[model samples]
Target: MAATAAGLTGSLLLPAAQAAKPARPLVIAHRGASALRPEHTLAAYAKAIADGADFIEPDLVSTKDGVPVARHEAFLSETTDVAKRPEFASRHVRKTIDGVTHDGWFVEDFTLAELKTLRTIERIPQSRPGSARYDGMFQVPTLEEVIDFLAAQSATVGRTIGLIPELKHSTYFARLGLPLEERVIATLAAHEYTRRAPVEIQSFEVANLRMLREKLGKRANLRLVQLVGVGPVKPSDVAATGGSLTYADMATPAGLRAIAEYADVFAPPTRALIPLKKDGRLDTPTALAADARAAGLRLVTWTFRPENRFLAADFRDGAGDDARNEAGSIAEMRRYLALGLDGFFTDDPALGVKALAG
Candidate 1:
C-alpha cells in the first residue's frame, strides 16, 4: 500500500512540473485575438486566452460617465455600429483631440448606458473579413469587465492570465476633466489587483505615466510600460506639455534610461527594432533593443500581423492575398525573436506561440 501511494504522488507531481515549464518571449494578444474577433469585445479577449496568449491587451478610454472602457481610441465610429443608430445622429460632431480634428461619436460625449447601445464591428474589415462576420454581434467591454473576465478565465483554466491595459490619450482626457490615471488605478484597486497582480498599465504620453507612478506611490506595485511611436515626435506633442523631448529623443539611450526610472517595459514599433531599407525590405537592426536592455528595461514590439501589407516586402508572398501567410509571419517573428525581444504584441497569439516554440 505504501509503494502504491508513492507512485501516485509522483504521477501528480509530474503534471505540476510540466505545467511550470517557462514560456520564453511572451505573447501579448494585441486587442485580444483581434484578427479573429471584433476588437475590445469579450469575445475577442476570450478567443485570445483560448489561443494561449500570455496577456490580453486592452486600450482604455473613458465614457462620458467616466467609466473606463476598452477602445483603441476615444472615437467610436471606426469600430462600432454607431453610424447605423439613427438616435445618435445629433451626437455626431467634430472635435479636436490631442491636436488632431476628428468628426464622429466621441466616447467622452456618451454615458456608459448610451454607449452600451452600440455594438462592436471589425475595425479592419478590409484585411480581416473573417473577423468582420461577427460584427454587430459583440458589445463593447469596459476595463472592469475585462479584468473580471480575465480573473474568471484564470480560475477556470487553472493558470494565471495577464492583462496589459493601455491608457489612451491621457493628456487629451485630462483636458476634458476625465483623466484616465485615477479611473484606471481605482478600478484596479477595487478589484484587489493592486499588488503582485499580472497587470501592466501602458501609455504613449510621458507626463501621464509619470503622474501614474506618483499616484500609485509605494502602496500599489503595478508595472508600467511606455509605448514609443514612429517618426519624430509631433510639435503638438511637445507644445502640449511644454517639453522638448520627442519620440526620437525617447528612443535614444538617454531617453530609455529615463524611461527605466518609471517604466518596467519599453514597447516600440517593429521598425524601431529593424529598420526598412530603401526598397521597403527589412534592413539591419537598430541599437534601440540593446540600449533598452542596458537601461534595465524589457523590450516588446507591437502589431505583428500576417498580411502582406503589414509585413516587410521580403516576407510578403505577392500582394494579392489578404489572408495571413502563416509561414511568412512566423519567419518574420523568428527574425525579431533572434534580437532577444522580451515579448511581442501580435494579432495572432497562436502564431506567436508556435513561432516562439520553434
Candidate 2:
C-alpha cells in the first residue's frame, strides 16, 4: 500500500513520538526534492518536506567573503547566471583545481551580495526539463537562512525535518582561512542542533571529519560522515585531481574502522553498495553493509533516482530506464533496509517514503 499523505494522516502515518525513535533507513532528500525543483533552493527544500522526506541534504560552499552558502560547487558557471552577467566578466579567472585548470566564475571570487544577483539553474537540464522553469528564480542561500527556514518549517508542519550538510572542499575553504568545520559547527550550534536536534555533517576527506570531531569537542553530539566514491585517489588527491573521495579507503575494513573512530556514518556511492552488472542488473550488497557494521558504522548510500535504475535493477533485462525504474527502486530500498542501513539519499522522496515503510 502507498504511504499516507503527510498532512492527511500525519499522526497515524508516523506517530509524533516516533520521530524520536532511532531512524530506520531514512529517505533523505538530496538537495531537497531535486527531481521536482532546482536543487538547494528554498522551493526545492519546501517540496521535499511536503513530499515526505525525513531529511534535506545540502552541500555547503563558501563565497568570496567566506560566508557559508548552500551550493554543490565552488564555481557558479554550470548552475548559476554568473557566467552570463556582463558586469562580472572581469571576475572570471583560470585556476588549476583538483588537477584541471578551470576558467570560470568561481564562488570565492564573488561576495554574498554579488552572488545574490545571480539566480540558480538546473544542474542537469537533459534529465529534467521541468526544473529549467525555475532557472533564475532563486539566489544563493546562506546556510543560516536555510537552517532558520527549516526550523520554522518543522514547527509549522508538526513534523521533524533533519539536516545533512556537507562541508564541500574543506581543504580549499581552510586555505582561504575560513575553516569550514568551525563555520558549520557554529551555525548548527546556534540553531541548538549540534547534538540536541537531528543533524549530521559529511565530508569527502578523512582529515576534515577528524577536524570536526576534534573541534566540535567530544561532548558535541554532531555525527560525522565520510562520502566515498569509485575513484582511486584518497582525500589527498581530491584537491589535486578533483576526483571523488576514493573507494580505496571505503572498501577496506580498516578504512571503515578508522572512519567509525570519528564518523557515525559512511555514505558510499550506490555503486559501492550494489554493483551493477554489464547488463545493468544489481548484484547483492551484503558484503559492503556487513563490513561497515563490523566497524560499528552505519551505511548511507546516495543519489538513488529513477534515472539511475541500472544500479537498483533486480532483473538483467528490463523496460526503459524510467519505466523499469520504479520496481528497481522498491527492490533496492528493501534490500538496503534488510542490510540495516541508517539512511539513503534520493531525488524522489514520495517513492522513497513509500519504500521506507512499504
Candidate 3:
C-alpha cells in the first residue's frame, strides 16, 4: 500500500499506515537473478520473483517488426546461439552503431520469425556457468509480452510485481527511424501500464528524456527516470566534448537541474552518490544527490550488489561473495534508503522487500 506524493507522477511511497514499517532497501534483480539465469527470460524473471525480488528489470530493444523486446545487446551474437546458424551467416553484416563499428547479427536485421528460431546464451561466461544450460530455451520476449507477464505475475503473486525497463541505445534506435518514446507509451497504454501500474521507464540519454517530456505531456502519469553516471569531466566540459561523450555531464548540479525539469527520479550508481577514498570507507554522500533532491527530483541509486560493497573498509570483505545474505544486504540498503530515496533498483529485490517489511 504505497501512498502517492505531491508533484509525483507515479506512486513510490508505501501507505502512511505502512510508512512506519521497518524495511530494508529494495533488491531489484538486475536481470532476473541474472547472476544465475540468462538475462531477460521468463525463467530469470520467475526465479527473481521466487527469490524475493520486488521488481524485475528488463533492458529493452526492438524486433525486426518494430516490436519492443527484452534484450541487452541489439545483436544476438553475445547472448544467443545466432552464430551457430549457417543460414544467418550471410545475414551477419557489419554496421557502425553507438559510435562503434560492430559486425554481427543485428536484431533489426532479423524478423521475429527468424529470431524465434534462435536460442539465447550466456552473455558473460566467466562469471556464470549455470546460465549456459538455458541456452536456446526461451525466445527473445517482446516488451508487450513482458508487460503482459508483469500483469499476470502481479495477479499470481497477490502483490504488484513492478517492472523497470531501461531504454538501451535509444539514440541508435531513434536514428533507425523508430522513436522509442512513442512505441513505449503505446505499449504501456495498450497494456494499461501507465502511472497507475507498477512500471517505470528509464533512459541514459538526456535528449531521450526531453523527448519523453514532450511525448508524455506535462502531467503524464508515468514516472520518468534520468539515468546518469559519475565521471571525471565537468558538466560544461563534457557537453562541449559532445556526441556520445561519457555521462560526466550528469554529475554536476547544473546538469542535474536540467534533468529535474522533466524527470521525477535521478538514478546513478551507488558509488557515485557515495564515493570512497583510498583509506577505504566512503567520503560523505556527494552533493549530487542533494542537488537532485533540491531540484525536486527523487534520488534513486542502485545495483547495490554485494560485489560492490567492497568500499566499506571495516565491513567484512567476504560478504561480497554471499549474494543471498538477506540480513546483511538489508542493512546496507538501509544506509541508502534512509537518505530519503524515492525508490531503488536492485538485482535482489527480496532484500529490499524484506528490509521494507521489517
Candidate 4:
C-alpha cells in the first residue's frame, strides 16, 4: 500500500502547535567547524560547539576492527594524509562502493589503531587554505569519542547539543561484512544516546534506514533523515521492488509520504530544493519544503560554503579576485531561512549562526 501522511500516527507526526516555524532555523555544523579545521576531527567538533551550532554532523564509516569513526567517506585519501604514510602505502587498493569504483585507502582496510596514525587534511584546500594549516595536527576520532565530547560540551554550555551522524556507504559496507547500522546503533546505545538525546541518523540509502527503524523499534524517537543526492537513485535504494527511483522521485508528494513512514526529516542539496534559473539567480522555491512538511517530515538542507563559485551569480559580489564572498553566502542562507527551512548544514557554523540571527 502507498503511504500517506494522514495515515501516520504516534511519534511520526508532530502536534500542530509544535509544528510552527521557529524564529531562527537550526545551524548544523557540517563535519564539525570544517571551514576552520580539518573535518571530522575533535578540534572541528569542539570549535563547532563553541561557535553556537545547534548540531554537529559526523559522517560515520567503520574501521577494520568494527569501530565506527568519523569520516566523510570510507575512502581516506581525500581528507586524510594516508597517502603520504610510506608504511601503509601497500594498503592502497581499488574497490566498488555503492556501484561506483573507488581507488584509495578505504577505512575498512585498517584497524582503529592503524587508522589513528593518519592525520586529517582539508578536503578542499584551494577554497579553504586556512583549514589546511591544521593538517597532521589531529587524529581521526571514533563515534564514541565524538558522543562523549558532545555530552561534555552540552554540560559545560548548559544546553543540549545535537549529533547528526550519516552512515556512509551502508550497503557496500554490509557486503564487506561491516554493516554500519548495527555498529552505529550499538555505539549510541552504549553511550546512552539512544533515547531522549538530540541525535539523528542520516543516510542516502533507503533500505538501511528501514533496517535501523526496525532495530530501534518503538523507542526510536531520535530523528531519521533521508539524504537526497543530485543524480538518479541507486539500485540498492530500490532493491525491494526491482524498480527504479530517482532522488527527484523522493521529492514528490507520494515519495515524501512514503519517506515519512520511517524518516522524520528530509535533507536534500540546496540546488534540489532551489535550483538556479537561466540568469544564475535562484528560481522559485520547489514544492519540496511544503510537500515534506505536509507529509509529517521536517526539512533541512546541506553543505553551505562561502565561495563565489558556489554562490548564485546574483548573490555574488565583485567578480574576479574578490570571489570568496561571505556576504553572498549569508544572503543566500537568509533567503533559504525565509522559506521556513528547519535547519541547514554549513561548513562555517559561526557564519550560519550569525546569518540566522540577522
Off by over 4 Å in 1: 1-23, 193-196, 217-221, 234-237, 319-321
Pairs that collide, model 1: none
Clashes of each: 0, 4, 16, 0
lDDT of each: 0.81, 0.74, 0.67, 0.81
Q: On TM-score, who's better, 1 or 3?
A: 1
lDDT of 1 by residue, 102-202 (tens): 89889998899998989999988989999999988988888889888888887887777878899888878887898787777667655633223466778
How would you encode candidate 4's per-residue C-alpha lDDT over 1-358 as one tens digit per residue? 1222222223232322222343568899999998889999999999999999999998999899888899988889999999999999898899877666878899999999999888999898887788889988999999889988888888898888878899998877887798787677766765544234567789998998887665443343477789987666653656534768878788889988998888878998998888899989999988888888999888999878877778877788866432567888899999888778999999888889889778
Alpha-carbon lDDT of model 1 = 0.81
Q: Give me the candidate number with maximum TM-score.
A: 1
TM-score, per-candidate, Cα-based: 0.90, 0.85, 0.80, 0.90
Q: What number of backbone clashes does candidate 1 have, counting pairs of residues 3 or more apart or in separate chains?
A: 0
Residue 338 of model 2, lDDT score? 71
**Residue-wise lDDT of candidate 3 within 1-358, one digit each (tens)?**
1222222323322221211211443456787777678888887888888777766888887776766778875877988888999998998888875555778889887877888788778786554556767877887777777777877777787876667788877767766776566666566655544444555578876776676666444442345678875675322223434744456666677767777777777888887777777877657777776888787776778765433342255343454443234455667667766676767766555556666665
Clashes of 3: 16
